[model samples]
Target: MSTQQTISKHLDKSVIWLFVIVFLISASVFAYRYKNYKTCEDVAFTVKAKEFRVGELIKFTDNTDQAANWEWDFGDSTDVKTNKEVLHIFNKEGEYKVRLLVNNICQDEKTVTIKEKLFIIDSTKLPVFNVKSSIVVGETLNVEDKTNNASTWEWRFGETTRVNSVEKRASYVYKTPGLKTISLVVNGDVKHTTTKQINVLPIEKKEERISEITGTNRRLGDGIKARPLGYEDKDKEKTKDEPSDKPKVVPFIGDSQFISKLELVSNNKLDANAFKEYFCGDINKNIIVNGKNTSFLIFCEKIKNKKLRIKDITIYREKGSNCINTVTISQNKILGIF
Candidate 1:
């Protein structure tokens, strides 16, 4: 009874243990396979950028698993891109909705804006002066000027003087003056003129001027034809043709021009003669006076170190003719008189 019963019990136990081991191995293998297999819902899609300029190109990407296919919508009216990375252009300036679908189940959406950035003109030239305001009975008349970006200048001081200056300064003499008009032209383009009223008083009643007459080392006032007729040291002299240490007399000459002697006294008195000498038929070369040039009348005054006041400027077709027109000037306006 002991041997038979023991063998039968051992066999039964072995069979039950084998069945349990096989069942456990099969269950473990099935669980591992289920964990690795991915569905369309498990994949994720993304866009690399969220902002772009107007008319700029953009790209979309997918980082999803089991995403063998992709579809894109750029919100603009255009065809879609089926690749993982698709190129798109934003043509308009506004916010746009971007959508990407991966494997027909995974999806991502983004919003971006395209924009354009916001652009004034400025032009005006400097002012030129033609004449001064007043002169004393015995005061000297010196004309000068200051300007920029000008290539030429013309100055005219009524019938007493006409000057052409390449420098910024020139001069004229008015021995007697009631009223005169002074004019200036720049770059052969712009023209400016003013009329002044010179009230001549007695020599004793005039006031002395604050400045004195001196030679100029630099070029004379504004753009004109004449080179500087001033002075400088021997070593600091300018070119050979340029006038150095020499003074030119301001002459008034023309068929209708009158030459007058003018002087400024120490007491600020302006002494001027009213249309004294005749400048009729005086043939000359490049005759420049009062900023105007002709063949007979020449301006010879060097106003580097002098100051003169102008009263009125009258233009006539001929000498001793009636005043046809007049120009008025302001008190605050600055002038260069030689």
Candidate 2:
């Protein structure tokens, strides 16, 4: 072969090999790019901000696995950050689109809103009111809101979970005896509410309780009020009973109230006397507790030092005078194994 023809032939062979190598390299790169695009379904990240407001610092963190390269566009500014985590502050209050480019391929976007500054109110400067700290049951409890700027009022008398009154000056008569909480929400702002506590005292020993009913009450039946003083006939009790003037007054107590008082007695905060009005003014009224027979006063004393979980409580009342007839309780003593 001629010398020029041999050299040209070698050059042609070298050019063909170069083209084959370039085609193989391009095909491998295209396949790898296609695999990465298919598996990048979950482009996950987290944004942490104590409060999303103007001038607040917001932290953006990329949570994608095997994410080596990061591109964060906070969307508020044209600047982009290349880091796994970045902190940015928005200068204005509005919604902004946030975007992230993971490993220069996986792309995702989210929206963040910056809010205006919230109005702050001093809770100490909230409306104040006045009420008597203690009052007898059946007596009217008067309250007056003294806040000068208060035109609307919401009053809740802790006896029930309800708004009892709306006037600036309110009054309520308690039917049961115990501590009660009174709340006032002025200007319809319940967040800055003012509250007061009042104690409704039971009828004292000296207080006179006239029987409104005409029929005579059951006297010392079924070991109830074990004392021999006949409650029905004053004439029969004039000689047998020790007291001659004052009629024995039993304070009226609701079934729910009785259960609460029992809990207080278990905590040692109260005693059997707390339920005097429930049982013909006799704390020692006979009753059944968890199928065990015992006096009311003795039952209270038994659980006085116990931490108890009340399982069930039942109260029976005389239909005539609404006086407590029988009480059955089922309570579990907690941490009192001995």
Candidate 3:
């Protein structure tokens, strides 16, 4: 054979082997991808929930084969999680679309409806008793139970000679006058007990009351008095000698007068000196205005521009001393009147 012909034959053989190898590799890759695609298409999952109420927990389970990873979306604007089995809780009552993704490629979804739970027991409605705290002796006392979810009731009338009853409502009469304790108990899975006191008073008699009144009058006559008996002339002389420190009676001002004063101040008809006299403190350039210590001129300037009226004024006096302590004035448009 010629050298050129031999070299061409070898080159042709190498090209054929390379083509076969390439075909084999392509076929293997195609087969692998086809298997994975079929597995993804056949992916399935199930959602299990014991209850569909708010605050209930739900479980998600992936039931597909050939899955390497899992992801879940609870559809409640929450963060997505990656797990084969996931547990989630809904905070509100609404319909939520739950989804499960297998191998990050195949997915399935289901809608869950969460509703609000009803028939919840309130703590305030627990077993309780209601009865009058004071009753006169010889009068019948009636008591009622305000208990809830109780199957039976027990009541104790707190009398030595009285008998207890299992009825919800009970009545008892006492012949004595004093403090008495009443108790109640409700029978159920959990027993509840409550106790109260009643003050039983004795009926008053007119003859015994008249003697008591005379005795009280005698005790009052024995106490100290402002003036001695038959000393009215001397007491009048002493009163003339000493001047009283009592505050003189001032005529009550109506709401109209207060409104007129406010209007005059706002219209510049009333000066600051006159306005300051209405307050209890010393008139100066600065005073507390609206809880803040500020210049009196600024305070007056603010009110002068606004239409204002005094709503109310309360004057407080020091106890025993009877001297005026402070005056609180409430205005319709302005604050901080001390």
Candidate 4:
């Protein structure tokens, strides 16, 4: 064979191999482009509603894997977050159409119903009474009126029931004499009860013991002389008109010359207005001191200080009322007798 012909054949074979390689490379590039191209249905997605309430937080999870973005329409006339756990509030009560659009490719939706819940208020009550002060024992006192709000009433007299009833005015007679506790329960509520002490004394006990004292007229000017007062009852009287117990002092002082008509109390407390009405002048006053009672009468012309300083001193019996042994004292130094 000729050398030029063989060389020409070899060049043609090389050109054919080069063309085959270029064609194969172009086909691979076209196949790669076609594989990567996406349709509208590729990145599609949808969302399903789980559960929600009027004030509850709901989550909308996008179940699509290829979706790039999510759009949530919470159907409450408001837009909500498009995350996995999206929170939304349903203010009104009704069925809601909750819609979700995924990556502009696909759409998913669900419906949920919300309702209103009822609420109640809490309260506390306290008991009350009408009268609460100064209850005397052994006295059948009427109980205070109970209001209509009190549906129940209970009474406890610190003992078994001698008188038991639901009447508003209840009587409780204290059998024994001492401090007694009384309780009243109203409307199933208990309150701190009050205590009343009864002072019971015998009925036939003697009442008055103080007897009147009189002195001679010539010796009366020696600063008003009088013996130590003694108690006398009806039988053991030193004089015929005296009672015969230990005679208590029946002393009366007034502002006038009339002194015999005033009423004297047993505890040495005297009523001055009665003495003043019996006497003519203004009844200055009288008081008891050191187991002795004395009376005074001072005129307005004899006033020294702005206030009258009436001296009520202790008086010892000056030996058959010859001269009364006494000590001068201020007004505050003696027990007051009005």
Candidate 4 per-residue lDDT, tens place, 1-338, comes to 99999999999999999999999999999999677643335332343334443465555565566555667877777855666446566776567887777655577667776654222212233333444343444456456644546656655443332224455556665444322334454564322222222232223455896699786667546777465667445464547865556423334332222222221322233333444322222233222432332333211111222232344433333242222222222342111121
Q: Model 2: which ten-residue window has the lowest total lDDT?
A: 329-338
CA lDDT of each candidate?
A: 0.49, 0.74, 0.63, 0.44
Q: Kindly list the per-residue Cα lDDT of model 1 for residues 1-338, writing each as its tens digit.
A: 79999999999999999999999999999899677555676555555544565556666677776777788888887788899777777766667888887766677787866653110011234335545567654576666655567667676554444343445576655554344445555565332322233343335555888697886576656456554677455764546657656432333443222222222321223222222232221212123334443222122232212343334333333323332221121111112211
Q: Give the lDDT ranking, best first.
A: 2, 3, 1, 4
Model 1 is weakest, by summed lDDT over 10 consecutive residues, at 325-334
For model 4, the local distance difference test gives 0.44
Candidate 3 segments whose C-alpha is farther than 4 A from its true place: 1-38, 125-338
lDDT string for model 3 (1-338, tens) is: 99999999999999999999999999999999877663577777777778877788888788888777888888888999998888888987768888888877788888988865423444464558777878888998988887766668766555531236778888888776755556565773221235566877889776643444333345655777686677658777988999689644333434466457657877988744453333322222233332433333334445775667556655554454333333445554333222
Estimate the TM-score for candidate 1. 0.25
- Compared with the true structure, what per-residue lDDT tens digits does model 2 show for residues 304-329? 67766778888887665566867887
RMSD in order of candidates: 27.3, 17.5, 22.9, 31.6
